[model samples]
Target: MPYARLLTPLLLVCSNVFMTFAWYGHLKYRSVALPKVILISWGIAFFEYLLMVPANRMGSTVYSAPQLKGLQEVITLLVFAGFSTLYLGQALKWNHWAGFGLILVAAWLIFLE
Candidate 1:
């Protein structure tokens, strides 16, 4: 389908946002009990699975498994960077960017024909 290529990445982005928050948003509330945090995270992750499963399924039509994985990782890094900076109030240093750049290169390699 013509929409698969475009829609897959969009769904992945949405899914990653929920995922990044589910995994890390609790950091802002360190005082919360561990059990509560885990429960909340699980609840958030439920929405992530809702999008991620379909994203992978639809993405498979136009992209190989490895390509879909590469795309997801790249998108994860990008989403995490923003979530870490904005949501977590953490600054990304130069080395962080450098490491992410290397990962980007790896993703490029995965995409290569």
Candidate 2:
């Protein structure tokens, strides 16, 4: 695989990890206050954008925008799955794996010429 192709997925995964926390982690801080949570989320989101922009640029060389978007979605799910399992201490059931497989198929279809 080309370096851009390899880096695209890694960067997408990193970007999603930052985004998931930025968007969802604020719920844990809701007791503190909404504005404070929003500020923190924005701070984290800055990092998400940093990685996401580069990922899209690197991926674009080998993929159309729609294909890159699909690739990001698949990477996002995989990152979320790992984050949920390892950080959130959640169990991934068969249904979740099936859903991921379906997403993978969607990715394949999107990338297919």
Candidate 3:
């Protein structure tokens, strides 16, 4: 717990990277069989769980459940934005930014008393 405040978010970011891949990495391989894609995604998701479990447990020591969840959501959006643009070559639209901005606002409010 020496760096739980810093380490928690770092772990969360790493976990979200794996999760974005597991949940959306199959989109590039439309020709792949559904069963195969499912298997591959599940395999990738296992790594996500490994990091996510510890992140939540350690984060809980410093942040409330709602705060932790909000933090994770923000991390997810940030990670997915990069993955979508760089890995998938998909450009994010203005609308996507607006929507994600609102979510960021919501995450900010979660820390409020």
lDDT of 3 by residue, 1-113 (tens): 67899999999999999999999999999999999999999999999999999999999999999999999999999999999999999989999999999999999999999
Cα lDDT tens digits, model 1, 1-113, are 78999999999999999999999999999999999999999999999999999999999999999999999999999999999999899989999999999999999999999
Error at 6, model 2, angstroms: 1.8
Candidate 2 overall lDDT versus native? 0.87
Global fold similarity of model 3 (TM-score): 0.98
Which is better, 1 or 2, measured by TM-score? 1
Candidate 3: stretches off by over 4 Å: none
Consecutive 10-residue window with the lowest summed lDDT within model 3 = 1-10
What are the lDDT scores of the predictions, listed in order? 0.97, 0.87, 0.96
The clash numbers for all candidates, in the given order, read 0, 0, 0
Over 4 Å off in model 1, which ranges? none
TM-score on alpha carbons, each prediction:
0.98, 0.86, 0.98
Candidate 2 regions off by >4 Å?
none
Clashing pairs in 1: none
Q: If both were scored by lDDT, which would come out higher, candidate 1 or candidate 3?
A: 1
Candidates 2 and 3: which is better by TM-score? 3
For candidate 3, the lDDT comes to 0.96
